[model samples]
Target: MIRQLPLVAFCMMAACAVPDYRPVRAPIPAPQPEPAPQVNPQSAKERFLRAVEANGCEVNASNSAVILAGATLSQQDLARILQELKDEGRGSVAPDGTGFRVNTGACA
Candidate 1:
């Protein structure tokens, strides 16, 4: 009986033993870098008109030329402006005997 009690006690102790458990977690993904800002490409005419407007000149476009009103620019300044417009493929600039004009739709 004494041997049986020891064995029974040992069996009870063994039955009471619990296995340790831990929850497994998934690995976190690395953060991705932000994309660069997209820049809109402007046409040559658009750039030219922007410059004209910046110089405080009002521009109007016709089928053959661009008319400038309220502009007090010198002939040399007009020539330089025309050259820049021409270099950008915006077309030639000529004096309309009144105001500056560009053959392209740069003013539009």
Candidate 2:
């Protein structure tokens, strides 16, 4: 009976042992991105006008005609742009004296 009592006391002491604890790691968040800048697209008429201006031609606002010099836009490039404008129904290009008259539907 005395030996049984000692064994029982040891079992009770074992049951009162301290518990171990561990820290848990947390997850990181992602960074936010900045928005892009806004840009306005150019119209077909605007593009054609820019091309003529780039070639150093004089644009007549009164009749929408561009005075083409000897060193102005090449014949091939002019023809291509004129054709494109015609196909899109935006305008037409026709020979007017020394320069070419451009019939742009809307200057806007």
Candidate 3:
């Protein structure tokens, strides 16, 4: 019993000993950047018409063409608007009988 007492004491001492422990933290992930806004083709055309109006021209878009009414714009101004639309892959613009026509390619 005396010999067993020492073994029991050692077991109790081992059980009461402070355990080595450390707090672990998970790694934080980096924040992702926001995606760019998508451009709508119909809205693009509308905005183009508004821009033309602001530049002293009246413009409207139909199924077959973009009609210019009331105000007359200089060839340079007209060309600039048409080129911008074309470069955006929106459509091809050509002068029709009384107005300009935009043959749209596809929506953005």
RMSD to the true structure for each prediction, in A, is 8.9, 10.3, 9.6
Clashing residue pairs, backbone N/CA/C < 3 A, model 1: none
- The number of the candidate with the highest TM-score is 1
The TM-score measured for candidate 2 stands at: 0.29
What is the C-alpha lDDT profile of model 2 across 21-78, one tens digit per residue? 5576676767778767776566544556665555443334432334234224544655
Candidates arranged by TM-score, highest first: 1, 3, 2
Tens-digit lDDT string for candidate 3 (1-108): 998999999999998896868787888989999998996545434655554544334233442123333223444555676778668755443455344434442221
lDDT of model 1 at residue 19?
A: 65
Question: Candidate 1: lDDT over CA atoms?
Answer: 0.54
Cα lDDT tens digits for candidate 1, 6-89: 999998999779665767688898999999899776654455565565543433343112322323444465566667866876
Candidate models: Cα lDDT each: 0.54, 0.53, 0.53
How displaced is residue 17 in candidate 3, in Å? 7.4
TM-score of 1: 0.32
